[model samples]
Target: MKGLILAAGRGSRLLPISATRPKHTLPVGGVPIIMRAVQALREAGIDDIGIVTSASSEAALRDVTLGSGHLTFIRQAEALGTGDATLCARTFLEGQPTLLYLGDNLFGDSLRPVMDALDGADAVIGVKRVPNPQAYGVAVVEGGLLRRLVEKPRTPESDLAACGVFAFQPRVLDDVADLPPSTRGEIEFPEALTAILARGGRVRALEFTGFWSDAGTPRDLLDTNAYFLAELRPRVQGQVVNSQVTGTVVVEPGAVVENCTLTGPVWIGPHARVSGSAVGPFVSIGAHSHVSGASIRDSLVDAFTRVQSPERALSRAVVGRHALIGPPGEEGLQLVVGDRSVVRL
Candidate 1:
């Protein structure tokens, strides 16, 4: 069995942050989403893995997966649909069963259950019962088999939402080649699977009840960061001075915290400095970042970011890498930030 990760998407929704790097490179809990996806596959005992990347991300993807001796990179020529991206790995797949994991998605549970259920199945898609099914690819299941797959159906027929994790047989490539373009003019992977379903292929379903995030937008990314951060084991290796740190927080080496209050499920990357601030409760401060005179919670401050907003509390925010977001000079400034709104100040 082989593991294939689709990481070629441009990630337009996650702009500014993803503008310089590939979507798959976005970090959650200080680990790249693509890397975590690869780790998940490895944990499931599928060591032979191939990553589908675009030209823009090919080099970085290789660099990120370098230490993994068994990982291979497959370049996708165009920004086609998921089907096209997976199709690029056809040669590498070589008729072996493959697990197609979406790059942006982070699943809390292991894929071993799905792999175990693929003993004689044509395909098995990981599904979760979500409150809002309209935003996901809804799967219609009957008698433990996939009846049909709908792409964001207006009125969802079932609560089973496709979590972008799929196991496909060798014949899946033929179906992908024969698929018609979706409304967006790209060969949709689901449409390709429709052909396989019509031919009586035995596609099964595996239900996942734990946390899952498809970090498409900024808010989604922030939420995912918090979710995964909470699951991490707490550790502190940095220099703490007159600071109060509590509960499941990871402070890597070279980090310095002075006169600050930090509450965990949080991650402070290496070389980061937090002074005269309160950071905590599901927050991630990237490498080399400086947080001074600020109160941040449930937020993600990217690498090299400098945030010094002591007056106004920062919550549910995403500060892009190298960004300088803070209150204006001369003080006495009042700002009202809206929820889910992006601000450059």
Candidate 2:
């Protein structure tokens, strides 16, 4: 089975981070978010993947998936809604049964069950009960079939929120093509789902009770990191020196830790360096990064970053790649720096 990953949206909520890299490229547990999706598809026996991306993200997307033969890229010229992004991959789809995943959504369960159910249904949508369905594309399911879908209704009739994972027969492309642009000037997938329902197409809902998260905003990313860490429990594997650690922590191979205090629930990626610092409780240091003479708690430091003395970063922050923090005389406080950014203080 082929898979379609919709990664075209410009993640405005993520701001500076998304400005430099696509949301899919954001690191979660030291791995790019989209790579996680790719692994999930591969694990489900679907190696052939098609990614629909906006032109702005083409280069970064290619760089991330380098040497992956089963992957293909299609450019969506506009940030049209989910329906249009899926339509961008229509040429490569070639009438095969396809699995569609939102680039931002992460699921804990294997996708095989939904894939199996797709054989008998026109479309299979992953749904989960959420406390606030009114904020999502809510689904009403009856007798194991999806009865209706209301897109962000003010008063939702159900708690079954669409989780943005869908398996659809190729014929669903027709519905996508026929959909007119929504008031927001983007082709909406919920509209296509509605069209399918009106045509007597059976839409199956897989009520997943496992872990799932969509990292659309900064807070969401932090929450997802904590959620996955509950299960991942990454352990430090490389040499350590002069560091104090407490609780659960994972340091990947070749990582260096010295003169640092790492509280539990922290992950230091491969080849990363943690020196003369107080880290963790909730922290993820990306590969090849260095942190010294600093205090970081509840933060994510991306690849190749350097955090020197007189630096203190607190709750819910992301420091991007190749960044330099703390020049000669700088104040210590909370900071979120983008890729290649430099801060004097």
Clashes of each: 0, 6
lDDT (10s digit) by residue, model 1, range 180-259 = 87878887776766687899888888999999889999889989999889889977898889988889889899999899
The number of the candidate with the highest lDDT is 1
Model 2 agreement with the true structure over 250-329: per-residue lDDT tens digits: 89999999988988788888999889888877788899998888888777888999888743454566777897776344
Residue 251, candidate 1: Cα error in Å is 0.7
- Among these predictions, the greatest TM-score belongs to 1
Query: What C-alpha lDDT do the candidate models reach, one value each?
Result: 0.86, 0.85
Q: Once superposed on the true structure, which residue ranges of model 2 sit more than 4 Å away at CA? A: 67-69, 311-313, 327-345
Candidate 1, superposed: residue stretches over 4 Å from native: 331-341
